[model samples]
Target chain A: MEQRKATIRTACVEALPLAIAIAAYGLSYGVLATQVDFNALTAVLMSVLVFSGSAQLVAVAMLAGGAGLTSVLLTVVLLNLRNLLYGAALADGLGPAKKWTSLLAFGITDEPFVLASSRFQKVGPDPLYFAVVAGIFYIAWIFSSLTGALIGDHLDPQKFGLDLAFPVTFAALLVPGLKGKPVIGTALAAVLMALCLEWFKPGNELTIIITGLLAPLVGLFMHRRSDHG
Target chain B: MVNQWILIGVLAVATYVSRVLGLTVMAGRELNPAVRLYFNYVPTAIIVALIVKQIFIPSGGHLVLSLPVLAACLAGALAILLFKKFLPSVVAGVVVGLLVRYFL
Candidate 1:
């Protein structure tokens, strides 16, 4: 019991910083959703149900651009392909949760996956920690969406540099884990691949999924080389 | 109205299925060591890609580097390196990025 409390406490502390970043995106999503003719209730409902920043933002932007339902669905499916990678990576860590893994799978996204995977690497599987982090992010996402919807276009996320929070938070999370050649090589490879993909056609939909699938091979190759050498 | 509801419901189901399928399919299986190592490096690659995407915004179908975001990322990276902390580094980065946005 005491251990569980400690785990929850640690999870909350770790999750809070990322939650704020997630909220920043959520706020922007809310404002955008409203602009696309979604009422505050429906906008907030999407957050409650979907809870994906990229998908929600892109879906609203597409709808605002007068995209059809089929196009929107197809794009969202493409955007969410990375979730498969995240979920597969996280499955072992969350396996201990048994039946609850199904429930917890709802929280499998970028931010939670980063934090949860790092925690699992350090101390092995801890589903309680994953649950706590996901729960905090979920609450943060919904509340911020509601606030953004209520305030409408009055809140410009970029004006306050809320847009910076996402990358900055990601950098903060990433910098510490960059150790040794394989990992650093992987990061550098990802950067180059992403830049190339984006350069070829700016804002290309395939950037994330393609980079994620291929960049890790650089790390794997380096890992093998180092082992043999 | 009904169309919106149906769209939301379809999306909700599609997203949930994507999330659950990976976990259920991979959870019980024992992955090869090389495969596990590859999975371990996946997050770093993905996170770095995410950061890069944000730093370079698309404009007129071309990539335009955002100085404020780059500065913010650099500040955040340096702060974490110096302080060995998370929240303060993020705060520092946001403040630095905001100043850049307003002043320069």
Candidate 2:
């Protein structure tokens, strides 16, 4: 019992910083969702249910851009594809949790994956620790989303410049991950492809899905080239 | 409202299935290196595409660069690069974007 308590405490301390970051993004997400017509209830509920920062933000942004339901769903699926890798990487560490692994899988997004994978590497499989960290982040994400939604509900999106929040928030999220040549190549390819598609037909629905499908191949090619050199 | 609910339901199921499949079906399996690299780069691609879509807005059957959006994204990018923080960077971007909107 004491050991379990210690694990929980350690997890809380470690997860706190990331949890705060998640909250900040969640707040932004909540506000953005509202700009796209999501009320407080639906916005918070999306956070409660989807629990994915990239997927949710992308969905709202796409919707605001006048994307249809199919397009939004397709984009989300593309975004969620990485969860497969994260899950595969984390499976062994979470294997010891038995049936509980299914429940724990709900928290398999980026931040949790990073923290849990590092913890697993250092001390072996620790589902309890994973649970603690995920739980803290989950609470932070949900509550901050609610708070942001409520706050956004009252304000005029344009007057307060909340309309600018979508691009800015995405830029903030995208900038930190811009490391290494291959990743940078992928982003540049995506930008060019998206620009071409949009230029061909303004507000074209195919731009996002097509760019998402093709641009990553550039990254793969670069990665293989670097590997052989 | 119903559409939103349906969207949420579909997203929840889709997201959970991806998570569970990795832990169960794909567990202990070695993904091909090429496939892994592709998967790894997908987010960067998708995020960049999303940002591009925002930066270039559609108007009257043609695309026009929205300076405010572009400025906001640039400011946001600069802030994140300098401070390495999320919220503040977003705030800085929005503030700059708003200033540009007001002045120009």
Candidate 3:
């Protein structure tokens, strides 16, 4: 129990930076959801259920564009497809556990996965600790969205530089993981895809899905050829 | 009024479907090696993708040539990478973004 407490404490401490980013981004999503016609309940529920920052951004954009239900579903599913990749990486780190623990895997996100997977290598995969981190971030996100939704369109986040939080949080999460050529190539491809897609598919979430799916293929092919040669 | 509620309900279910499908299907399985390799690297790809969009394109068809945003974000990344301190990096980025938005 003492070891468990320590692990949870350490996980929470390490997760603080990501927690702030999630809260700030969630708030923005909630406010935007309201402006896009979702009421408070729907807005909050989306954040709790989806819990993906970029997908939520795309969701409101679709809502604003009067996208049909099928289109919205396709767009959101594609935008968040990366979470499957995230979940797959995370499953290995889950350690020896029972079937019931799988419930916590549903709440997995970028921050918790990174923290848990990296630490699990050393800590031996405490599901309780991972669950604690996920729960903290999940609560922070839901409440932050609620706060922002209630605040409505009055506050200017651009003035407070909230937009910058997304990039900064992303950078902090990304840089430490840039280890090799294939990874760098994948990043470059993703960047190129994002830029090019913006020209044609403005506000569409499919760009993320396409870029994420393709970049790794480019990386893997290059890696294999280079390895053989 | 009812129409709006209906739309919201549809979106809510759609969003839930996306999330639940991934979680339920992929949970408790060992990832194929190729997919595992991709997951390890894709986070960087996703972040770089988003960052490139922000630095080059700020609005609809309007490019902001604001060097401050770029410099600040770079500085923030550098600080966190160097010191492993996230809050300071966050402050650096937030300060730079606000300064560029306000003064520039």
Among all candidates shown, the one with the greatest TM-score: 2
Over the stretch A1-229, how does candidate 3's per-residue lDDT look in tens digits? 8887787788789888788977876766666666666667877877776666655665564444345556555555554566676565556556454574556765666677778878877867577777888888888989988887886555565666655655665576567677677887787788788777766655455555567667777777667777888
Tens digit of lDDT per residue, candidate 1, span A7-41? 99999999998898888777767766776677898
* Model 2, runs deviating above 4 Å: none
Ten residues in sequence with the least summed lDDT for candidate 1 chain A:
A58-67
Can you tell me which runs of candidate 1 are displaced by over 4 Å? A1-47, A51-101, A104-154, B1-15, B58-63, B83-88
Let me know the DockQ for model 3: 0.33
Model 2 residue A52 distance off true place after TM-score fit, in angstroms: 0.7
Kindly report the root-mean-square deviation of model 3 from the true structure over all alpha carbons.
5.6
lDDT value, candidate 1, whole model: 0.82
Model 3 chain B scores worst on lDDT over the 10 consecutive residues at B1-10
lDDT of 2 by residue, A116-211 (tens): 999899989999999999999999999999999998899998898998998999899988888999999999999999999989988888898999
User: Relative to the unseen true structure, what is the C-alpha lDDT of residue A86 in candidate 1, on a scale of 0 to 100?
Assistant: 80
Q: What proportion of true contacts does candidate 1 retain? A: 0.69
Tens-digit lDDT string for candidate 1 (B1-101): 22677677778888888899778775556667787677667767777777888898889998999999899999999999999876678779989999988
Steric overlap count per candidate: 0, 0, 0
Candidate ranking (DockQ, best to worst)? 2, 1, 3
